[model samples]
Target chain A: MKKIESLSEYRALLGENKKTHNGIDKNCFLLPSGMEKFISAGKVYYRSYDQGILIFIDENSYYNLYYYIEKGSCFPVFSCEKPVLIEELSQNGSRDAYIAANEARLKAAGFGFYRKSFQYEIGIGAEEPQRFCTAEDEQAVKASGFRYDTACYADFRPQIISLWKESLDFGDISGDDLALELSQDEELLTVISGDGAVACTYLYEIVGRDVSEGRHVVTNPSYYRKGLGSFVLGLTLDHLRAEGIKRHYTWIHEQNIPSVRMHERLGFLQNGRSSIQYILK
Target chain B: MEEMMQILKGVRPDVDFENEKLLIDNKVLDSFDIITIVSEFNENFDIEIDVEDLEPYNFNTIEAMWELITKLQEEG
Candidate 1:
């Protein structure tokens, strides 16, 4: 596995496999638009194999593996901070090949299969201003005494961090670092309680002109079963629809049956997309 | 304890909640399962278990969950 560093090197590698590179499209593999983002990110690792090129983008605790096989075939594995979560599968690779390629190394390093996230992409329509919240959801929010507020980043900073801590189990994520990333996005929706935030979700611009990435739909675990998750998701979807965003895409863990159900209820399709995660102990 | 086990089984009949103690640590039960189980506990016991009480330690075992309910009920 050779480390692909410069743009020239990456391009040369791609040039070696032009036939495979040409087949990728938005509807298929998650091919990188450019190597510039990966190179500049500074933690990216690349290697050339007999039939494909392996690219690993390490985002501190989370790492994304992009295995570009010959003929434009690609597979991606998105990992959580602790490396315990093996997420996302390739559209073209076989399960055996995927496991053989990475499973041994991951297992030797102490990880195990945590969960799987099913990717969803939806086409948004220009609907009238309507509520996505259910009666039960509204009642739960009211009973819990949390307020829905569309506040600026400054106001949302401290509360959002706490919510992340309570919802996500990975301890490697630093609240300060997360705050820095959250500041980059322009849109946010939050459910707040007394002096704190209970639930929140945000949207960030993607590479395409009208596509936005829906991210970090988190709620404090203490507030679970109170409809906070649905409330936040509904508010975010309504806002996105109003913005005329053509498509919305997100990954929901297979284990989160309620979330999957909620998204389906909101009209997002399963799309028959599957990703595999291999955890090591 | 039996009641808690019954509810757990009802939510996830496939899992042997009586024997599986690593429910939370092993990720056997996902977030949604935890949410459902918590809701059931709240409704059946008439106790409000806030998010702060939702740590993995409390839901890892039927015994731990029963203890949590008892504590919350007594506190109320």
Candidate 2:
């Protein structure tokens, strides 16, 4: 296997694999610009073998490995300073083959199945609207000096990193990743701040002309039960609606009952798609 | 082109679409803005703009957008 340093070469190899494997969807992989940004941020590492390419995305505490195999065989070998997560989107049928091929290596590396997450989706106007935050809650939040606004990624990078470190168990993002995403036209990071602290944050990506994905939402643990999450999410949804986004979706772990309930209350329903994560320490 | 400018202004009044050539590259227009523009163009021009036609090259400037709309109308 040879290390791929140039973005053009990486793209060409990916394009060749796509041309050969008709079932592969390019969208499943990170966009070229995103890959370039991550590489520039020094957070992305990738290599190519005879059969395919493997990409390792370095988050602060963990790594995410994404691979494209030409012969339908998937096995990635890499060293990491922290835990590594390998996720398989359920929409792809090759997940079974991928796991089968990598099972032995993963076990040898002390990896185990982590958890299964279900995808939830909602149409902007397809269903009757439900208020995630009541007028009273909004008024209270506002009166308390908590204000919601969209901001550049740098505005709350430190706060977000701190909050995710304390609250999130998986898919924790790094400041470099956030900085890279800020360069994209479709990424939006909204926040609620007051009293010299960021109370809550919502980050999403506009995936298509009328579709957006809820990437991450984190509220300072100290602000829990204050309706900050609901308040911020409601405003974010309204912003998305005004921007002509017709659909929104997100993934939540099945065991996360509170998050499941909150999303359900906000009108998101399970979309019958699920993915599994395998983690190696 | 003036009519197109009107539509663009209607979506985002702050931008000077006439002189700003790098609408997509400069981040003058975001994905949301693009969606609104596409919807407006499709309805106003009675031309179908497929997802394939939503590339940055076709929308980086008023001239590029007009050319794309004209091409789509001609194809129709």
* Residue range B1-76, candidate 2, lDDT tens digits: 7789888887666577879888876666655466557756876797866434666788889999999999989988
Q: Measured by TM-score, how close is model 2 to the native structure?
A: 0.61
Local error of candidate 1 at residue B75 (angstroms): 76
Off by over 4 Å in 2: A1-3, A6-8, A11-53, A57-63, A68-83, A92-105, A108-110, A126-136, A152-160, A171-186, B1-76
Q: Candidate 2's residue-wise lDDT over A139-251, tens digit each?
A: 88889988778874467677776676676564544455555555567788888888878888888987754667897788897788887776777777877887777777888
lDDT of 1 at A220: 62
How closely does chain A match the true chain A in each prediction, as TM-score?
0.66, 0.72
Per-prediction DockQ comes to: 0.01, 0.04
* Root-mean-square deviation of Cα positions for candidate 1 versus the true structure, in angstroms: 20.5
lDDT of 1 by residue, A1-281 (tens): 34556756665665565455543211112223334556765656765555555565665555555544543233333333333334445322323353455555445545565656666666665653445655676667667766675555466667677666556644344455466566665545444453365455443444233455566677666666665666777766666676766556677777777778877877777644456565422
**Top-scoring candidate (DockQ):** 2
In candidate 1 chain A, what residue range of length 10 has the lowest lDDT sum?
Answer: A23-32
Number of the predicted model whose lDDT against the real structure is largest? 2
